[model samples]
Target: MGEWRDVFDIKRDSAPVEEIAARIDADSTVKGANLVILIMAIFIASVGLNMNSVAVIIGAMLISPLMGGIVATGYGMATYDMHFIKKSLVKLSFQVVFALLTAAVYFSLTPITTPSPEMLARTAPTAWDVIIALCGGIAGAIGNTRQEKSNVIPGVAIATALMPPLCTAGYGIAAHSFHFFGGALYLFFINCFFITFSSFLIFKILRVPVCGGVSEAHFRYQRWFLIVCGLVVTVPSLYMAYVTANENIRDSQVKSFISQDMDLEASSVVAYELDHGVLIVDVIGAPLDDQEIERLQASLHQYGQLRQTTLKVVQGPASQLNQEQVQEIINARLANELKNDSGKSYKELANQYYGSYKRDAADQNLLRSLNRQAPVLFPAVRQISGGTLSTLNGEEETEGRQWLAYIVVSRQLTADEAGRLQQWIQTQADMPVVVNIQLQDTPSQFYGNGIDWNP
Candidate 1:
């Protein structure tokens, strides 16, 4: 019993009250250097979100100064320092506004408008996030009261993650996605509310002494307000967690049913789409007869999780499948695979993910440059759009990737107009590009990807 008490005790090595209070007050004050660090943290976090680089995001968290303010505010509450609490809250609010506006401006001007994995993760925080914030806040508070500082403070900053979500909210503002803004803002609020509340609990446990004094009525009032605020912040996260858990369970069941249970002959599953409890699986090779499809659908009951899920199997030859849809599925699969694999270096992984953004930017630039250059080079050309096409041998992409461009025009071009356009494309690519000229009546849409229609 004595050994257990010795091991479990926290007040044994606590710092002097004055020293601890002074430190918390210092950290809580938002000033010149801290403000600068906060702004820099926001940009770093925003870039990490833009690039989908987790390491960069972690680096940003390391430098973030928001934890100081949060912990200090909690200490203030524990000590009943209303004046200090007011000052800290005011400074913290200013920091948040500065960070959000800076992030919004950066995102608005940047070319990478697409949401990255880091960005998406913040936009849909659940109960798990709340738990993490609480644990992190508790750890941070305990660390701050210690006579010696430890890695726990920095680690807590990363775990609670105050900066990324704010920047994601800024991104939502820049992108005009109210859904993203609201969700991310809610996540930030969860972190802030829980962390501060946890710190208050820890400070009380450690028995942080009151500075001036406290009235009984004010203490009760503050306590009730905190309770109400906690409820308000926590309920939505619980609901989100429930929804997220169901989605994950449904996805797992659908995948299991597709891979293990649904038996098909002379066909392979190509892509899938799950929506509102409906599962749509696209397969290529051999077409299934209606009876076989019905059997597969009926077999969903075998998996308890998928019983409510509606399964529809679409079977057609590779030529009949939607090329754009299949390509998107492939890209998503590959990206997710690489993201979860711990085998790759973070730099290499970053490149792989960042390459997708670069490709999108490149595609848009090409379209703009080509369209602008079109009238001067080939007046007969109305507009140009281009994409990469994988040369397929059967259902497998065998040859390689090639740039496929489409030129939309109302009438046939003169020999000079046609010649210039072809030369420009080859010069730009440094490789032979397959060009497709469309008549006003019949514009070509990646018709049947397996066949090479290059003339």
Candidate 2:
């Protein structure tokens, strides 16, 4: 126990109380050079977040003066120095307001409105953030008390990341997104409160002498007020962290269930929404039957969080098989299964079924036009398939539809020849056409083997 105590002991050195107070007092004042530094830091952070550059953001964090006021407040509160506390709070408020306004103006002027990963990351405060701020605050306070300070203050600033959250909140303000604004502000508040709280604890532990005289009743009231304030900040942060953790778990389970249970070939989850015990999964690929969907829903019971979730499976049009087509596919699959010596794998059978289904579903006139004109224009072409390219949102354009033709060629074709073929196809079909050419050729000095010969 004596050994442990020695290991954990923090011994004060040559740094006098007056010198420490002066330094804290200087840092807490936001004017002249300090105010300029704060504004520049905010601008730099805003730019870094806008450009999604982590290095630039870190640099901004290093130069940020926001931590000074917070530390001063914590130190003052710990020593019961009301004058010091009032001065620190006022300076901190000014810095916060100035930083927010500066960042908001910068974001409003910039054209790039999309949130970067750094920006989005600061929008959500978690339990981990509280822990980080607390630890960082203690480390920072220790560094401040030392006679010879190291680079710990810069490290603490970077770790706490006070600037980015303010910039993110400013972005929200500029974009008029209340959700982003509120969440980011809450994150900043958490960091500020925890850092101050931790600093208070550290100062008290270090047994710093009180600056002014006070009555016993007044001291007790002040202590309770601080405790209540800490609780008020902490309770909501704990709940937010819980919600965030649960959301992450739900997302993981959703992905696992989709990948493992859903047996649709060439399929992908287009979108999903989970709300109030209801999960809506929109999948694009071969549609699942009622029995298969039921099986999937039943299988979800293995994941405790999703056990009570109501599953709503939405089928995309690309794989929405009609009753007759579905029956034909089932019959073909059954026949393939019955003949174990069919010499074709299950994947091959499925591919064949999908090909036939797509061909049948294709526009007859467009398919005929492609089949007739592709060979005429490029005799080296062996197979041709055409389809209209849909937007990412799965919406098909009525006008100016982009028709894509995927052609597999027996021999390599030159860029000019491919271009000519594309123009001829467009002329024959009387539509906007995009030709994707694939070549089956041996490896040569000029070209690689089985190249994607696009023009």
- Cα RMSDs of all predictions? 9.9, 13.4
- Clashing residue pairs, backbone N/CA/C < 3 A, model 1: none
lDDT of 2: 0.77
lDDT leader: 1
Model 1 over residues 1-455: C-alpha lDDT tens digits?
99998897888988988899889887876778887888789999999999999999999999999888877778888889888888888878888888889999999999988777678778888999999999999999888889999899899988999999999999999999887798898999899989999999988988877877578898899989999999999898999999888767765776677767654668877656555567767678778888887788888867777777787886678676554555555556455544443112223423544655566667677778888887786666777778766577876865776777777786766555566677897677555687777765666575522222343
What are the per-residue Cα lDDT tens digits for candidate 2 across 74-163?
988888888888989998988888888888899999999877767878877887888999999989988887889889999999999999
Model 1 / residue 311 / CA error / Å = 2.5
Q: Best-fitting candidate, measured by TM-score? A: 1
Model 1 lDDT-worst window of ten: 341-350
